[model samples]
Target chain A: MIVDTPLLIITDLVKEFNDGEISTTVLNGLSLSLDRGEFVALLGPSGSGKSTLLSILGTLMRPTSGRFEMLGFNLIGARDVDLTEFRNQHIGFVFQAHNLLPDFTALENVMFPAATRKGRETPVDRRRATELLDKVGLADRRDFPASKLSGGQKQRVAVARALMNSPDLVLADEPTGNLDRESARRVMDLLIDLNGTDGTTFLISTHDETIAGQCRREIRLLDGRLARERH
Target chain B: MTYSFKVALRYLASNRAQTALLIAGVAVGVYIFVFMSALIGGLAVLLLNRTVGNIAHVTIQAPDRDPVSLYGRDSGTLVAILKSVQQRTTLQSAAAFLPAIEAIPNVTSVAGVVAGNGFLTKGEAIAPVIVTGVEPDQVSAIANVAGNLVAGSGDLTIGIALIGSGLAKTMGLQVGQRVSIRSERNIDATLLIGGVFSLGVSSVDDGAIYVHLRTARVLFELPDGVSRLEVKLDDLRLAPEVARRIANTTGLKSIPWTEKNEQLLNGLVAQARSGDVIKGFALVTIVIGVASALLLSTYRRQSEIGIMRAMGATRRFVVGVFMIQGGLIGLAGGLLGAGLGYLSLLPFPLPEATSSTGLPIAIGEGAYGTAILLTFIGAIFAAIWPASAASRVDPVKVIGP
Candidate 1:
């Protein structure tokens, strides 16, 4: 039964990978939905298709078959250009490696998503980027090049960049995967804090129980299929 | 700057060695282009000037045929006999045509001469010669014969004549030596050799002599006829038009220098066409080099391109970024090439040369501007395919990998 009008809907999503003559199912009839401000974790072991589902959700890859909708807009059959625009305006991604564009400064990295949308940096953008850096406790390190920052700082900048465009959803694909224990804790704390304050939906794919435990909900995948959900 | 432009700058700045190499390649190409055009163009102009400097731009002479009477055949027969007996190749009273010709716009100078074949004798030896009657100042103004004079004054007096150095040497004569010259009509005169000159042409130097117009008329027994009139114009290129105008106005046949030097002009045109081919090849090499360099650059920046695409840069924006990079590189190279080419020409000044140094070249502003524009376009065109390839980078595959 439909309890409420959800911000996202996915009905029997399917994804498969082909290597020459043979094909393997990465996601099999998987279905999930999210509200406007939900902090959800996708938990799975290796080869469980958690990353594949996240890739499809982020519009980086096409699904084999399914109906996926976000804010009442059909996403499954959208054209490539429309998908790219949808991602730019509505979805932000934080990769495990931070993916901070090594050539840019921390502040520039934080402002990049917004600049990519606007095609230029304005004074208001600079102020917003500075405020985001300040919120992430990396104000003093804003001018530093991303390459020069510590692993923790880069992840923090990636988080700030993800929020720069004020996207409706932030997809974190094992964002703390490469970090040390302390850096991982800090990154998890940052994501939780942003989720709590900003009221933005989050879909974090992680195998780490400690990170998943911190989320409001955890959905586990088994053998390319959704096995259980816990809240 | 736009996002793409900033990204382009960042990419180029990060790849210093590649950028430097590309600029250097373009600079060298531009240098070659500028140097070749200047060298060949300068040599062409020099050859043209040397060939036509002392020659007439246009020459006016009497019509080769005599007019026939329309009324009677006997009248035509009498006119033909008179013309044959009178040696009608000469223009009767050609001096009257000078003022009319000189009045034409663009005509710098006009000079008439009476010329005929004769012989010079000393003691027992005799040499055949071509004698010319000229007003020294007027002929010098039109033909610039005074500039090539090897010795003595150009003044032609009644009893004095100027003989070519070869003729003077053959007759065992020097300045102030007396020589007997006889015309084809059996008229003879004994004149003193007042000057010796060398016109560089062996035919003229070996057998030509100059005398006063009155003396030549008396020697030829013509009283008042000239062989031909030579005209100089402000611009030699205007010779055909001036010749046409003179022919229309004076009822005289005018021959321009281009008609007289048809073979040489044809050779020069062929040389220029070959020069253009070489320039075209050089430009192609430069364009290919730039294209190859940009293609390598595109592959090297594939990851960055993927991230940019993932960040929501459109395919057109991605292509624009690489195009900007290519344009900037080409612009930098073209400007640098122009500077390099200009500097290379500074060491040698014009009008000084040897076999080793060859001739000094002149580079014009038009050549520099043209080279810059051509390379800019070539560089942009060279970048299109690579930029398109860069735009086609798959974000999911590239980013994940």
Candidate 2:
């Protein structure tokens, strides 16, 4: 499933934040591309625009000036509604804080994308969600509320949710940033296993060098631009 | 169910205490609305019943004749004048109009009456009185005279009559006693008092007497037609329309009870307006309470909303979740409040003979349907601000840096 064709392309992307008299440029002329089914890690220090890049790629933020094409369609100037649908169909996200709806069960959290997209939960969605939960080693905890889960378990559920829609690309921002060493290892293993079996591409932003070493490619950002790349 | 609705339910179920408190607040507001509606509605009914119970809903009488001057055609001078102050105006051919008057919709009963001024004389005392004559069987058709009788029976025979308690007291007259009645037309007769009644109206209780129509014609010297017609209606509110129809059909002067009781109608209207203001305030309070609480909830769940947005949930979806929550609260609160209002008023009995001054709350008039519909709609309106705010949450800012 590792195709030679590129899945996404970025050129001369720029992003700036303004507060009255102050203008802070988060991404300045940064550009990168990813091929289908590639596992890439984004490495950067604090305030190095790693998260900003992930946000733009996930279609959650608009770049001030850039050319962004994902799945052969231009995304830089797309309408918000169109972008929302494109993201739901083509992109997935796992936040650093494991932002699952605390009131819902693990299985419900995993089924959130499909249920919201279809307007209601169907039998197929339930089956897929149950399978995802079992794959994440939380089959017994499928009915447990998100608030009742431990931090690491919550992160694992977040990963399962990001994969529930079967999106082509998953943008994970420090997915295991708040977990202990053992929990972090287990989550990373799960991500790798899913990528190898399903052929889903992953672009993970992380400060942990050990996590970056496990990816097929590593990208480093410095002062809002690509500083280095290694394979 | 739709995911939006499911999510709204989950959110509410997660915060049980807050949800219950919000619903309770809405219920209290709805209860106030229902209470006001029932009280004001009940008071109006009570007033109308008391006022219209003892009088005709519509009265048809002969048109008044004003004096006119005879002018000479050749000169601008008044030649002669015609004026009569003592002439009695009687409805001519009253019997011919009874069928037409009774045919009007909502007309329950119609009675032809002969009324005239007279004097009641006992052996040692004399009192001025008004003598009303009607058919023996229809004595209570317009006024409930039979129901108010305190002694003897409401019998109107050729030589027997009914007198008010005030007139009976002043002359020391009792049932089975004879009294002399002298009419303004100079006709006189001695009749035995068959009954005594107290109608609660001071003027009527002091001087009114009832006699047979045959005897009244002879005493008042009305040999041709009855004096006037008294009309009763099933619904007193239809009096004006019924009176209009009667006047058109009978060629007589018709008067409705509402025109005669202007002050009472005005008081009832003012009371209703005040109740509306109170009900309006209650709804406003409910709207404010729901809006503020939902706004807080939106703020508290910012990160969750951000996650949903990042997961490709549309702004409309987010809005639907919040609005559904508001609608649910409104519907539940409305039902609870209406039930509570009804149950609370059940202990207070309606006004009756045993308790004439009972609590004036009409439980059946609580306006439950209106309360529920308004509250449900109001709650949805209240959630607009919060729903919009939640939909506008920035996914990047909350979920990322």
Q: How many residue pairs clash in each candidate?
A: 0, 0
- Candidate 2, B1-401: lDDT as tens digits: 88899999989999999999999999999999999998888777666766676788998898878777899999979998887567888987888878777788899999988989988888868899999989998889987889999999987788889988988887888999999999988899999999999887767888999999988999999877888889989988888998899888877999999899999879988999999999999999999999999999999999999999988899999999999999999999999998898888778666332256566777777899999999999999999999999999999888763
Q: What is the TM-score of each candidate against the true structure?
A: 0.82, 0.90
Kindly report the TM-score of the first chain in candidate 1. 0.96
**Candidate number of the best TM-score:** 2
Question: Candidate 1 has which clashing residue pairs, if any?
Answer: none
> Which candidate number has the best lDDT?
2
Model 1 alpha-carbon miss at residue B387, Å: 1.1
RMSD of each: 5.0, 3.3
Q: Which stretches of candidate 1 lie over 4 Å from their true place?
A: A1-5, B57-143, B154-256, B351-357
